[model samples]
Target chain A: MKRFATKLLTAVLLAMFLFVGTQGFAQTINIALANNPISQALNKLAKEKYKAAGVTVNIAVLPENDLRQKLTTEASTGGTSYDMFFIGPYEAASWAKNGWLENLEPYFKAMPAAKLTAYDRPDLIQGMVGSLAVKGQSYALPFYGESSFIMYNKELFAAKGLTMPAEPTWDQIYDLAKKINDPAKGIVGMTMRGAPGWGMSGAPFVTIVNAFGGKFYDMKWNATVDTPEQRAAWAMYKKVLRDAGQPDILSYTYNECIALMQSGKAGIYYDATSIAPALEGAGSKVQGKVGYAMAPHQKMMTNTSWLWNWAMGINPKSSDAKKKATFDFMVWATSKEYAKMSVDLDPTGSSTPPAARTSTYALPAYSKTPYAAMTVKALKAMDFTKPTIDPVPYVGLQYIAIPEFADAGTQMTQFLADYVVDKITLDEAIKKTNDVFNQVAVDGGYRK
Target chain B: MKKKNDWPFILPAIFVVAVMTQVPFLLTVVYSTLRWNLARPDMPIVFSGIDNYLFFLKIPDFTVVPEFYSIVLQTIIVTVVALVICTVIGFLFSILLDHPIPGVNIARTLIMGPFFVMSTVTGVIWKTTILNTTFGWYGVLAKSIGLAPVDLLSYYPLPVIIFLFCWQWIPFFVLIILAGLQGISGELVDSMRIDGLNWWQSTFRVKLPLIMNHIRVAVMLGLVFIVKEFGLILVTTAGGPGTRSYTLPYQVYMQIFSASNVGRAGALATMTVVLTLLAVNFVSKSMKKNNL
Candidate 1:
């Protein structure tokens, strides 16, 4: 009996070893991404497309903040858990400078002509490409690009006998909001991000400040947060939000604003154009009732729309084989063919994810979508070279490009929130914000 | 000779403790002394002894904001308030559970449920479902009754966080105090009543004194946990409405991740450790003096 048991155990151990060895031969690439509709579609397509090529794709979709924390920790330690990571333009330059991202220029240059031409390098949006570049070298590929815009309920406008122009000023928006606001009917005049984060409320607020002729800094890196333009912008924003916005404006983020618009509770929603599909998709209460317009401007010196993109970058610490697999997957994921496939898979006009490729925008199926023309126009109208009316050191529309800008912007957002909620006066908020920005610039050696 | 033989049995635990506790702490101290800013990699790291510490401690003459001092005060207030509330409420619940009543076992389990729920979930449920101005029960109920819905978290972020911490920790105190109550001899309670003491007097004079040690242990544990609270603030308010709810841990997190200043973060972390150690020491010394 002992001999028989020993033989059986040996057979089981050998079987397990063979099973594990066979599993190792199949290539698998892991991706870390934020939880969003575009990522969800890409994860599904990656599995279906890569399975036949003897490759497996695994995706870990996490909340926005959680994904940021995970990626930051991984980059700091040079961990190899994720071969590819989704990064926003705000962190791309910093990540590249820190040697956390693999430069993709070499891979793009080495690609075969057939694949290169098929990919159509010139078709990618210029601003999107520029945002993902470091020192003229591309470090990431744009999966989808977006800029902010205003989505208003046409039915509400008609009912209230209000007319919304194709290009409205900030004053016009405020006037419309006041006219249409009806708390007793559960209709909010406007929905905007008020959550306290650099990327949340700060993004829209910066755009507003720019339209008000305010610049974050002068060429000498002297903080201009205390300028008259900025103070006027803050005052206007607070008045509009207090008199026309929903209650608890301080707690409302993009998600809350989206919910408010989709449920027909909001008359105007100013946020990323990426929310267009979700708002117009099936089962939405306000589907087919929404009208689009450019982001509101004040002085018309600079457009108020903010440019942002969700892009993918290869991990610098990943093994060569994993990097190759990751690049291959990324190329296919962001290609025009994949964009068509995404639309085909869903077939709903609403499933068409915003494409970065010019060719994809020209597709008949995509153009027929409700907000496609407006989105493409906004994308073209984005001016990254001159994000503000006055000359400044930063290149971003919604944020300053330097890494220290995150902390500075977050601090300013807090003071802005205090001003909005009546916790502090406008002068106090402006002084505190200027102090924080000046301190950051000095500490970073950006100013004498 | 026996002691020499016992070294093998104790060496593994000592090694684990050193690796788990001492090594990281030593690394934090070392890192705190360097000029390490991840954002400015062009600048090389150098020895910068005590500069990071002074950066946090220094008060600017131009402004009276007292940023660091405010965070420290907020941390102390939250910890003390949460400790007092949890201990008092927990003691009351423990007395009620000590009696032999029908369905008491299930009732105890129900009361202890919040302790088992994760802190992140607690923050989310409270922020989104309970306290949110729109789509939340508070909002819906307020609107239904013709009243303006109040955003509790926006107006009272720190107090709401304190309530959440107390809610989560009261169960812990209840469980520990209940165990202490069970260990006490029932004859003492009967003897107190036989001496013409009322129920309330008996609880204060006898049961309270008997369970004072358990309460102290609970308070000490609560203080340690409260001082390290990050997820509750991170998920709910994110130390916001202009840093009104910024705690020490959240401040350290902002320094490292948001600011990308590793040296400053390390300095803040070391300070936090020292503060926690001092608090623990004070509490333990007081407990010894009281002989509870």
Candidate 2:
């Protein structure tokens, strides 16, 4: 009995020592990334680098919804499901405010030379880096940034004798959609994301609302859903979706719209500019025939372009070692050298995510690509300093920077979807959506 | 020895059930009473005394009364519709495949295929492959057949979702009822046939009543499963069409995850648990009455 007890104790101590030793010697970083082409490439690149450094990176590649759910679950629970994660500006700001993420400012400050080389540079597009701040805190680092744009089939335009302007308006896009639509040939005039998610649909909706001079909240953070500008925007958006867009558009997300465009089924696609590379890839039937332009406008281009990207955010709950390792990988992965390496590795150019660094655009290799000028122009035009026309008590390029925004935006998307499906008339949908916004405001103590 | 044998038959199952369900359920109830944000620095759980509940209730746009009621009503409508449709279709198909048909096995396999598909994948397939307005095969076929494109999701959302749910669920009903059909004593069926009643009469009077227990189990289980369904609603419509199809579980998700109001979310969850219990009691009571 004494011998058995002694043996058991020895085994337990051995196991504990093994765990600590392994944890100390080899830093294992868990990265939760969204399942996009860019993310896939990033994962592949990350594994190679981390493995070479004797670090094991457990990559949880999940669909966008699943990734968000898992990340949110882990974040909310204060669990260490991941050491590093991919987040966007909206999530970074709102989540950082909630203390859901580790502020990277301190780490960046600690490694000034590396940070300067990677993030702070004239060569790195100032807009991209500038967009990563929330309440004057650098919460995340941009891996890639994008503004929404209109990608049209130049062949279809030529065939239909339709002319696309240099900077097209919503009205012009509508007309073009009508002219080029040929359902008989399985071609639709346009495809836009109408799916019910803040990221999927709300991005475009914000742009539309902005173009119509519809501020979600007035300068005082008062509800503006019932405003005529918003109503007009909703009505116009509904009309365009009904007439020129694909059927069951409310089901379409970024990937679905991209598929529609790549398959030559869509004459126009209004979505994130990051899709330009995918659309220009060899697998795309419309590869060489696609043209890109800025997102359509109705009034002024207030927030016509949405600034969105997959970004690295450090987990607040991570151990110091884990945090350091995550920051190391993030800095390296987002570095100019990494971007060049990615481009070199990606012979197809589709795998390399468009990095936010201006040096990436300046690279002779990137400049010579099919999407070079248009993508860079769109990325450069991603102005985070001014997203909404009217001043509001928030900071987000394409989203309202509040914790309640996700819920409110989702509900708002559902209302917009209702308009698309013709379940409710434009007037009714607007009223209902306004009611939702007002209710949210009241509950949030933003209004009486 | 007999008493010793009794626990062996039940102990493992009880243990499994306790671990898998009862504990988590208790945890959820506890979680319902507190303000818990997963990502806080300290992970401090605050007791809000139903403040979250009141807050969720007071959100003018998403107040509990109209929205929750609408969601509940929609769920009931869809569940009932799916139940009737799946039962009828399943019954008919079961009868069709009972004996020998050239492609009966293949048809059976195909029917079961949708059941095996993950809910998210099924939603994706239905949304993109069939109901997609632009490149969906249905749209392509509609155009090919000289019909103007049908916006299935836009024009027919609830029915489309209900149809997809029913379509997926029918195979279970068919398979279970088929098992019940096969289990019936041949002598009893033969004796019934000897009485000179036609096939329909035999089925309606004897066979169906004999399988009433099976139907009760299948339909009630179906209802429970259907009512608790979150993935389909989450993936497909997300309880939209202006919350026309919003169900209880989807509402809970929207409240907690979307709204970030843990208190309100807990209240909604507690209410749903109460409602579900009430429903289960009503179903079981009605089932008992029918059995008696």
Candidate 3:
């Protein structure tokens, strides 16, 4: 009986090893991504497409901040738990500089020339490419990109006899908000993100600062938060949100803004062009009733819009086999064919990824979409390399490009929130923001 | 009875406690002294003693203190105020529920429901269904009554957070204190009644003394958990209108993720641990004195 039991145990152990060995030989890649609508659609598409090719795709969809934290920890430590990271322009440039990302240039060059030509790298929006590149090497592939724009309720505008301009200045926007604001009708004039975070209020607010010709630092990296242009930008944000924004303005973020606009309670919304999908398609109460305009500017007309992308990057420490699989998946996901294919999922082209490929805008399914033309125009017009009208050292339009910007920008966000809510005086806010920025500069050893 | 060789049996537990708790804490202390930053690869991570702590602690001028001090003050105010309310109101609820009233079991279960809820859900539910000005119950009720609904969260952030914290935590205080009240002998209650004590005197002077240990246990547990409350704050006010609602743990988070400064985060974390220990120690001592 003892001998029979021993033999049975041996057979079970052999079966387990066989199962484990088969798993090891199978192709699989793990991707960490932002939980956005585009990515959600991509997640479904890739699971089916990759599974057919005998490659397993495992994806973790995380909120923006949580994704950043997870990726930062994994990349910084050279961990290999994930092969691909869905990061933004801010992370791409900084992580590339840190040598945590796999440089995709060599891989692109090694691709079959026919495949490379089919990829048509130049057809990508130059701003999106620029944001994801360090020096000359591309670090990530843009799945989707957005330049900030103004989306307004056409029904509300027509009702109030307010015609939105082809191009609106900051002052004009404020005036429009005031003219269209109807508290009795339960419709507010504007919706802008007021919740505090570098990515929340900081993204749009920085562009407003740039439009007013305010630089966070000079060429020599001094804290420039107290300049005249800076003050004007500050006052504009405060006055606009306080006078015409939602009742719970201080607690508002882009998510809240999207909900308000989707509910048809907001007159105008100033945020990412990416929000066009949620407004124009799939459970929207205001479909086809929304109008698009360029991002409102002040002193700097050409670069008022902020450029952002949720793109995929390969971790350098990932196995070569895993990297290859990850890149293949990324290419197929971002290809023009994917845009055409997304129509099966959503006929409105709302779930279709936007602004990555120039060809995507020309697709018959996408061309008729309301936001396509304005999106391309805005994408072409934005120059993140020359963010502020005045020359500065940084390369980001909505954010400062230095690694310390996240921390520094977050500090400014708090001060801005306080200033907007009448919690602190303008002078006090300026002094405090300027002081914190200076301290970050000194601590980061950037000023030296 | 002869003592057995218990060291052999207890050694594994001691090893686990040292590895899981003590070693990580020591590592944090060591990391606090290093000048490590995850973002800037050009700058080499090296040992830079005291600089990280000084970053938060140093005040070049008295007129303008660093944000660390303000965040610390905010954390203390929120935690202390919430704990006090939980103790007072929780005791009152316990007294009311202690009587032989019909359907009291249902009332006890309903009161305990909030304590079992996750903090993030509590924040989201309250923000959307209750507090929102345009759509929430508060707004609809206020408007129907012909009054303008203020954004209570924005206008009064600290007070709102305090109230939410108490709403969730007061039941926990009752869970422990009510057990203490039940443990009091029935003969003791009869004697107190026979001594001609009024309701206030009986409940406060007699029953309160009996439950002092339970109150201490509840307060200590509440302080430890409430001091590190982050999720609710993140969902509710997001440590804003400005950083008026930021706490020690929030600063630690900002340092680690936003600043990507492991050393500074470690320093802030160590300081937080020390401050929490000081608070717990103070509460323990006072509660012990009360017991005596």
Which predicted model would earn the best DockQ?
Answer: 3
Candidate 3 chain B least-lDDT 10 residues: B1-10
The digit string of per-residue lDDT tens for model 3 on A1-448 reads 9999999999999999999998888788889778677788888887765443557888878766567777888888788989998888998978998899999998998899998888888988777887798888999999999989999999999998899998999999999998888777778999998887788899999999999999888877789999999999999998888888898987787777888999998998999999898899878899999999999988987779998998989999988888888898888888777887886668788888888888887878788888888888888788778888888877888998777887788779889999988888899899999988887788778887
Model 3 misplacement above 4 A: A1-28, A47-54, A109-118, B1-10, B194-196
Candidate 2 local Cα displacement, residue B278, angstroms: 2.4
Give the DockQ (2 decimals) of all models. Answer: 0.64, 0.43, 0.65
- Per-residue lDDT of model 3, residues B1-292, tens digit only: 6567766888999999999999999999999999988888788889999999998898877887578898899999999999999999999999988877999999999999999999999999999899999889999998888887899888889999999999999999999999999899999999988999999899988999888888888999999999998888988887887888888998888788777899999999999999999999998998787662
* Candidate 3: residue A438 lDDT (0-100): 88
Q: Which ten residues in a row have the lowest lDDT in candidate 1 chain B?
A: B1-10
Predicted candidate 3: interface RMSD?
1.7
Q: lDDT (0-100) at residue A326 of candidate 3?
A: 88
lDDT digits (tens) for residues A1-448 of candidate 2: 9999999999999999999887788878899888777778788887676443646778878867667767876777688979986888767766777787888878867886855764544555556666666666777888887787888999999988887886888888888898888766767898888877777788888888877777777766667788877887787777777787777677777778888888987898888877888887768899788888877777766357778877889999999988888888887777788887877876546766684776777767666777778777776665665666666666666687665677778788888887777676777676667677776666555654
Output the better candidate (1/2) by TM-score. 1
Q: Runs in model 2 with CA error above 4 Å? A: A1-28, A47-50, A105-123, A134-137, A301-303, A379-382, B1-65, B94-112, B290-292
TM-score-better candidate, 2 vs 3: 3
B93 Cα displacement, candidate 1 (Å)? 0.4
